[model samples]
Target: MSGKKEFGTTADGKQASLYTIRRGTCEADLTDFGASLVAFRTEDRDGRLTDVVLGYDDVRGYEEGDASMGGSVGRNANRIDGASFSLNGKTFCLDRNEGENNLHSGWNRYEKRIWKTEGVSADGTSITFSLYSPDGDQGFPGNLVISVTYSFPEEGALQLLWRAQADQDTVCNPTNHSYFNLNGQGSGTDICGHQVQIFAEQFIPVRKGGIPTGEQAEVEGTPFDFRAPKEIGADIERADEQLQLTGGYDHNYVLAEKQDRMRRAAVVFAPKTGLRMEVITDEPGLQFYTGNFLKKQKGKAGAVYDFRSGFAMETQYFPNAVNLPQFAQPVLRAGGAFESATVYRFSRVLP
Candidate 1:
């Protein structure tokens, strides 16, 4: 019969399913719970393979939790300062889930809600997950319909294609928050042995509350430099001003060297497992968060993920773009369409 339609009742009775895409040697397990990514597996240089990202064992974790990893986030992915914004002539208030800031569109955050899946390919290599957001569901005007496609090509790459359209004027910026560990999930803490290089020449400095300061500071001399390969924890705990302000490396890096279209943003590698991950995106900025807040959380296989267990390089226009006029706007006016791309190409790198 067909190779297990990718969509079926998971081990748990919550309508979860596994999806396999055919671009490379990748298989993405997606669940309707939180529209979450349950597992993303790929191989390395020696043909030894492993699951290289952190995710829940079932649907229950996503439906009632907030770790946010490997799940879709928001009508507004990041944050809106003070939990309010004035657009056109009217001002709207959002759920103050995090202090005075409204994050991930509030209450109706995709990371915490279920979505309906559609169209599973014969061999189980392509699948689509979609959700509809009603007018003012999260205090944002417009009924928004969002869809994301997961596909793997002949060469082994996992691509995320994001699409959204709204009927009324509103703001929308959605992103997947997947915590990746090239050495494989349930491994251990500290990505100390992994080497990374990002194409960013500058970075956004943040405040004590983790909000951007609106200034694009150069990443050359500081610990933020990743233009060349460097260990993630090399200068992480150094007493630098930016590092001190945000408690760790949780800032936005401005990707450079664009060729007028999509470009390479960052590369990550795990020396022990021979696994390497390359991120390519159309967005101008990439947020590098070192998972500085893991706080001994129990993850897959009952493994305790300590601080810096996994990291994320989320490509986007920018955070708090709604508050910063100079930054690329995240506003999608009525009748406007929003499109974005993020690709995580995996391969095993050996010494």
Candidate 2:
């Protein structure tokens, strides 16, 4: 498979560019708009290649803002309580959309802007996309230069490497918002059959608006326990107040020392298909969002995506970190480089 297929014209009805990177059976198509992934075709257990990612085939869908898709979330991913923070002894106010909380940089989100793209393959299995965020853009104090690398090697690992330098001090919490379904897109109605195991003994509980309550509790004997492989829907319908507040699983699980860095944070396996995926990241936390907001959208092959049809296990710094000094710090320094890596290794177990 190749990513050379035509995407579409530019947002202004002018010329458009398409970039592709292919290795073996893995191929991904990235268009200029929002630096989005138009197509990500990977092989399934039966050796069938499918576009497992949920996206709109037309460029207009991306311009119209239906889904975040495979775009890189930035400036800061997740929420920041009250849309305000105190840094350098000065108070900074941000655009608040989620009630009093700031969700994904509010009005100045990176998802809403186009990114400058360049196709680089020093080793042939990886392609890097780079963009520069101007100072004072998104109400942040920095002109940040960032790079995101997507690679698929023999290990079937998609390693996301972020390197950045701020012209001024700013917060850099970058993470890819790629939704996954190991059963393959359009193949079914839900990912409930897939089993998941997260390397987290405790998880940060969140309020109704998705902000942490500054309490990290153990997952033992609770539905949040994923130390062993369990169905995502096993405890999904529980009567827990936190679960009901978020509509589903939408909490950040605190990773163990090893799996939190230099190891896999979680592993998911589809017993029916033998497709196993392991997530390895340097980030301290992983957000488990069960697509609670996907309201019956059409996916590949005209298949409708119902709630929990797919899930996004995003690895990054804890949400609302700016407000909770007790949690891991999301702040970046002028001289220090901000780096976070997450790898998803996919392999087919023999029947």
Candidate 3:
């Protein structure tokens, strides 16, 4: 089933609309503002439908909120060292939203903009939102056209497909920043107890400002290790420099080399709800972030979200990849097209 409704009005007096798509008992709510995932509900082990992702009630909350929440990050996702990068021997400076580094493409975030509904599946199980960014927008080259498609192709899977084309050479790396709380967004419980397993042997370490140090450190014997299923809070509090730098797990894991097919990135299981979420993607990096900086903000249904209340599994290229020659470049050449897909498969873990 699928339908649309008026969410709210944007600051510019533009109307924002919400689109709902459902299969069986699983439902997903998305909005035209920022092409974001507003809400996602699925059946837990108790056979109760539960909203598992965190976000505000309307478009106003998303527009005013600093946290990306369930926003579709774009142009260049993640930080770029020194808030600048050179392409084709030309240096371009960007908005330094995070100290001297740029985070999520700075204040002109894609999440805050209104996107056009390109198409909605006839069966009402999928919707695509598109946006156009002129040249030098956010200090990046190219007149970029991007689209994000949200689809429910199966009973317990939500798939996201990102496609973009640039008229000129530019940096383009997009990802969905949805904070997931499998125990239900309104449960008011932190995700520390969730069992997580990341299929990565190494992770990128960051400096004081959360910019990658241009080196991939082994996760073995370290607090960053999650090669096996373990409670998220197990080593999060250990006396480790990496953990101390970012205040918690906010680094990117080095996924396997580029593959023609989708690869399993990570798995998260909420014991209390017996809900398991498996992340699959073709990207070469997976950013596992615990909501360490979440302030006590009012969320949907009078829920107050605090630190570590939710987590995000962002699939994309390495952070600062444009500046790091050792990492895979995320440059989209002139007139070139880019595409990537990420899927979140949900299931109930039987006791």
Candidate 4:
């Protein structure tokens, strides 16, 4: 099933609409304001519906609250060291929002803008949002046309698809930043108790300002190891330089090489709810953030969200890939098109 409703008005007086798509009892609420997944409701162990993803009840909270909550981040999803990159021998400078580095393409964020509703599937299981970025927008060179589709393709699964083409060669790495708490958004619980397992054997370590140190360090014998399911709080407070550097798990994990484009990236399970979420993506890296910076802020239905209240599994190309020779570049050639897909498969596991 699918439907649309008025979410609220943007600060700029633009009307923002919310679209809902459902498969069985599981449903996702998406907003045009950022083409974001505002809420995802699925059944728990007791067969009760629960909203797993975190967000506000209105569009204002999304605009004034956490900038990345359930947002579709784009143009370039992660940081660019020195706030600049050279493309085809031409250097392009970007906004330095995070010290001297550019985080999420600086202030001209795609997550804060409203996207055009390309179309909603007749079967009410999919919807697509489109956006146009002119050349020099946010210091990126390209007349880019992008589309993001949110769909419930099957029972217990939500898939996100991204497609884009640029008139000029440019950097294009997009990802969905959705903070998830399987205990329910209003459960007033932290995700520290959730068990997580990432398939990556290596991870990128960062220095100050969260820029990659340009090395893919082994996860073996380190706190970053997650080949087996373990509590998120396990070793999170250990005396480790990497954990202390970002205040938690904020670095990118180098996904193991796979011949298939679509592969399992990570798995997270909430014992309290018996809800298991498996992240599958085609991207080469998975950024596992523990919500280390979340302050005590009011969220949906007056729920107060505090530190470690939620976590994000962002699938994308490696951070600073545009500048690092060792990493795969995110460059999209002129007149060329590319597509990326990620699926969040959910199920109730019996404890």
| lDDT for 331 (candidate 2) | 78
Higher lDDT: candidate 2 or 4? 4
RMSD, one per candidate, in order: 2.7, 2.3, 0.8, 1.1
Expressed as tens digits, the lDDT of each residue in 96-167 for candidate 3 is 999999999999999999999998898888999999999999999989999999998898899999999999
lDDT of 4 by residue, 15-117 (tens): 8999999988889999998899999999999999999988999889888875499999989998999999998999999999999999999897999999999
lDDT score of model 1? 0.76
Higher-TM-score candidate among 1 and 3? 3
Order of the predicted models by TM-score, top scorer first: 3, 4, 2, 1
Q: How high is the lDDT of residue 141 in model 2?
A: 78
Q: Which stretches of candidate 2 lie above 4 Å from their native place?
A: 1-5, 14-16, 256-260
| TM-score quality measure for candidate 2 | 0.92
Q: What TM-score would every model get versus the actual structure? A: 0.92, 0.92, 0.99, 0.98
- State the local distance difference test value for candidate 2: 0.76
Indicate which candidate wins on lDDT: 3
Total clashing pairs for each candidate: 12, 0, 0, 0
lDDT of 1 by residue, 1-351 (tens): 113333434344546664545545667777665666667777766776577778765555555446687888878877778888888888899998778888677776777666887676666666778999898888888899988877665456778888989988888778888888887888874786789999888988877667788888888899999999999889988999889876678787887422136788999988888888899888767888888877776666676777888888777767787788877777887888878778888877566
Error of 2 at 253 (Å): 1.0
